[model samples]
Target: MVFEDLGIMPAILEALKGEGYINPTPIQEKAIPILIKGKDLQGCAQTGTGKTAAFAIPILQRLSQNPLQKQGPKPIRTLILTPTRELAIQIGESFASYGKNVNINHTVIFGGVSQGAQVDALRRGVDIVIATPGRLIDLNNQGLVALNKIEIFVLDEADRMLDMGFVNDVKKIIKLIPKHRQSIFFSATMPDSITQLASSILTQPQYVEVTPVSSTAETIAQELYFVDMVNKRDLLLHILKDKELKSILVFTRTKHGADKVVKLLERESIKAAAIHGNKSQNARQKALNDFKDKKLRVLVATDIAARGIDIDELELVINYEIPNIPETYVHRIGRTGRAGQIGKAISFCDSDERIYMRDILKLTKINIPVANEHPFLPAEGNTDLSTAVKPKAKAPLPRENRPRNHAYGSTSKGGNGQRKRENSF
Candidate 1:
């Protein structure tokens, strides 16, 4: 259905047309109506599902329809809490684009940078505030921000927040807001932790789900390559020789791994960049812009840094390192095949990571055809899919034993994992 049928205002409809968005995505079609009614909502959809517009459009309409009397500067009427600075910034951009003609104003604040400018923006006043949990709390504690004026509270990327260990901070922010406000919780997957968190925050919320985690986009062509862990880099370099696989996104599991991949690619005289927790805010933004503009041939990223990445006609995604969680595999591949474009997702699996491949196959419930024509294929390759050996069952690693590449949270088992937020600006 078209966006007009979803009750979006004329201003937003015009803005969307300028942005070349005529039809509504499935998530947008279902979630916008409930949210426009000022009802609490719980949405489960994967990345690249246009969920940002689903909420941002209605928010702009509501705030514009009910204009409040201004005393000095407008207090923040809506608060949107997200896990990463990238996603927070993207949401703020969405608000700006959709509300350009409206009277509402919004700003985004995150950690990893000096707060002087953010504080100055807060002082100037805004109607909507998009922020990461840590920086928001820091400003709130310093008496620079106030959430008591919030009429609508949004917790975007709830599952990612749990992955990043922002539950306590989220709970703290929830307590500060007025309890009578409307709430919206959106997550890619409803893990038990996210479900419980949604239950505590939402009051009789309406549920909307689209494109379950187990499914992948039909436009994507999936393939797998088996190689030794030591030769994965060589395999990647070899694959790039085609020159047709332009603008590829390579995923690594850790920050160090991402950096290592970048260095290796550079040594071969390939123009590439890395985005992760270790880079400065300016550096990360520059790298992302370069990749999007086709200045760089490759962009190496970790799972967290890649959450809010949206690029058009980005047809190639290479999994340099497979993720441990099966659901993560779906998220990684979903980066491509976006906006009605056909895409390709190629995965590199080493001997030790075969178990991960097995789990991914089980989760997607489809067998990925193996590409055996590559030059870097392992000597004992092409094993029987049904008889692949699983990793030996063992106790989880201790906190100190697990690698500390992520910005926040530990390698702990319980979802109560705690870590610092806003490591990357």
Candidate 2:
């Protein structure tokens, strides 16, 4: 449906036009109306669903339509809590773009950088504060920010917050805010934890689910590549030989893996960059900007670091390391095939990660066609899928015995499990 039908104001509509957004996605179509009514909303959707605009647009309209009495400085009227710095910054940018003509100002609060400027912005006053829990709490403790005046409270990427061990911090922030505020909760998936969190935060919220939690987009063609763990770099290089993949997002399980992949690509003179928790904020932003500008052929990132990455017409996503969590596979490929556009997801799987592939296949309930057209077959040169899962000469290492690389929330073994909270930042 067109945004005008969704109750968007004329000025915001004009702003959207300048941004090239005329129609709303399904999530936006459903969630925007309910949110514009000022009702508590619980949205279950994934990345690429345009969920940001679903809430951002309504928020700008509401705040603008109901102008509050003039005060000395703007108190925080809205609090949007997200998990990562990247997602928080992206949300802030969305607010700026959509609320340009409106009388609202937002300051993004994140870690990995000094808070001097963030504090300055807060002191100057803002109508909204889009923040990560840790930094917000830090500023709140120092009396630099306050949320008691919040009229709208939004918890974006709730599942990711819990996964990143920010649940306690989120609960703390909720306690600090007005309990009577209109709560907006959005999560890619609704596990029991997310369900309970929503129940506690939202009061009689209207449920708007645009997509099933377990499924991938039908517009995406899924392809699987079975290769040896040692030959993964070679397989990736071979795939890059296809110049048609003008821009590719490669997901690695760890920061070290991401760096290693970027190094391999750079050595071959293929422009590439890696983004993860370890990289500085400026470096990460530069890499992301480069990738968005198509200046980098490959942008390798870990799962958490890739949050809130919305690239227009991005058609390809590569899984350099298969994730143990099947649900994660859904989020990864969701980066492509955005807004009903056709896209492709190519996954590289080794014998060690066959279990992950099976889990993903079972969760998605679709047999991903093995792309055997590539020349990365084994010594036997067979294209059989089961051959990769066949018996091996040496037994696999136990989870504890394996060397682990901490990417974003690296657990005892590896992968995007839970890590410590962002307390210091």
Candidate 3:
């Protein structure tokens, strides 16, 4: 449905139209009205679902309707906590973009850069603040910012925050804010911990869930390449050589791996960048900007680095390393196929990662088609796909080494059909 149908202000609707957002995403459609009603909400939707706008629009409209009372320098009326600096910046941009026509002042704060600029912004007084948890805590502790006057509190990417070990920090921040304020928590996955956290914070909140946990977008075409780990880089290089790959996001399991992947690609004369926890905020932002501008061919990132990458027309996502957590597989592939656009997710799985691949399939309930014709595959030399051997099963240990006693105090008899002692000790 259109944004205007949600009862958004005419000015806000005009701003959305100017920004080319004519219709609301499913999450936005379900959330905007409830949010405008000034109620707490718990939203479960995957990334790239326009969740930022869902809350931003309603918040701007609400704040514009009831202007904050001026008491000395105005404290932040709205606080939005995100897991990463990139997401904080993105959410801030969304607020600024959608609230441009409206009379809302917003600022974003995160670490890895000078606090002087952020301090300046806070000094000037902003109506809304989007920030990373650590930086928010730091600014609060320094007495540069206060949350006591906050009217609305948002925890975006709640699962990612929990994954990054921000639960305690989140709790601390929540305690600092006014208890009576409206709270909204949005996450792609709702594990038990997230559920418990939400229950503790929200009071009779409206629950909006558009997708199941650990489920990948249906528009994505998933495929797997059974390649040797050593040849993964070569396979990636070959894929990048294709002219069809417009903008690619390559996911590595570790920060070091991301850096190495970027270095390798650069050595091959491919323009690429890496973003992770180790990189300074400036470097990460520059990389992201370059990738968005299409000046960079690829962006290699760890899961954390890629947490809030919302790029439209992202043509592909390559799993340089399969994630151990099945849910992470869904998040990684979600980098592409965003905003209802068709995309491709290609995974490079070696023999050791076959089990990981299976777990991902079971979680997402989508069988990724296996491709044995990739250049990295041993059978690629022969066009006959039948010659490719299936992955071999791991050999079992010797019989003597096997555990003799069962948990039920029973043991398998030998050829003599005799019972063994329950305990070998």
Candidate 4:
């Protein structure tokens, strides 16, 4: 349904229209109404389902209707706690975009950068504060932020926060907020710990769930390659050669793994970048922006860093390394096939990672089609499933001793742009 039917204010509706937002996503359609009614909500939705707008729009509308008159330089009326700086910034951007017509001011605060600018923003006063837990607690400890005034509290990516070991910090923040205020909670998946945490803070919250993390989207074509660990990189380069895999998001299990993937792709004269916790905030943001703008064709990222990446036309997600957590696999591939668009999730599984692959299969209850016709196919074992794909001629890999100076160019004629249709069963 259209966003207008959700009772969004004309000002916020105009801003949404300016952003070209037409229909409300499922999460938005369900959660917006409950949130606008001044009720606590628990939303279980995966990344790229427009979770930002579901909460941001209603918060902005609520604040606008009852403008804070206790103004001594606007105390924060809404506080959003996310797990990462990148996500905090993106949520802050969403508030700015959706609240432009509402005349609400908001700022994002995170660690890894000097608190000078964030402190300045706080001193100047803001209606909303979007922040990461660590920096938010640190600043509050230093008496820099006054959160007692918060009326609307949002704990976003709750599972990620707990996975990142921010449970204690979240608890501390919850204690600071007024007990009677409206609280909104979101998580990709909810474990018992998350359930307990929600019960402690929320008062009979309305639950809204869509596309549970255990399930992958039916629109995404899942492809698997059984390659040796050493040859997984080659498989990636080989697949990229098809030129049909445009704007790919590659996931690695570690910060170093992400960087290594980026370096390996660069050696083949492929433009790529890596984003992880170790990278400076600016570096990570630049890499993300470059990938979104299509200046860089590939962005290798660790799972935590990839949170809140909302790219609509992202067509491909490559799992260079399988995650130990089955649900993480869902989150990784969910980056593509967003907003009802068809996408592809291609994974490379080595013999050692077979267990991880098995876990993912058990969790999703879907057998990812194995693409067995690649050159890097493991020589032995059941790693390469005997699937129905007809074996095609193998492509030659560049010699290890070859110089890395060959420049790559965009090919006018590439493989058919059609996505491979396989029974994902």
Predicted model with the maximum lDDT: 1
Better of 3 and 4 by lDDT: 4
Give the Cα error of residue 324 in candidate 4, in Å.
9.1
Per-residue CA lDDT of model 2 for 138-223, tens digit only, reads: 99999988888999999998998897789999999999999888899999889998999999999999999975458899999999
Ranking by lDDT: 1, 2, 4, 3
Each prediction's TM-score against the native? Answer: 0.66, 0.66, 0.63, 0.65
**Backbone clash numbers for all candidates listed:** 1, 0, 0, 0
Candidate 2 clashing pairs, residues 3+ apart or interchain: none
In the range 105-151, model 3's lDDT, one tens digit per residue, is 77777776667878888887878888878878998899998788899
In candidate 4, what are the lDDT values of residues 54-158, reduced to their tens digit? 998889889889886664787988899988765665575566556666667788777766678788888888888888888888898999999998999999989
lDDT for position 172 in model 1: 97
- Pull out the clashing pairs in model 3: none
When summed lDDT is taken over every stretch of 10 residues in candidate 4, the lowest stretch is 406-415
Cα RMSD of all models vs. native, in order, equals 8.8, 9.6, 17.3, 11.8
TM-score of 1: 0.66
List the candidate numbers ranked by TM-score, top first. 1, 2, 4, 3
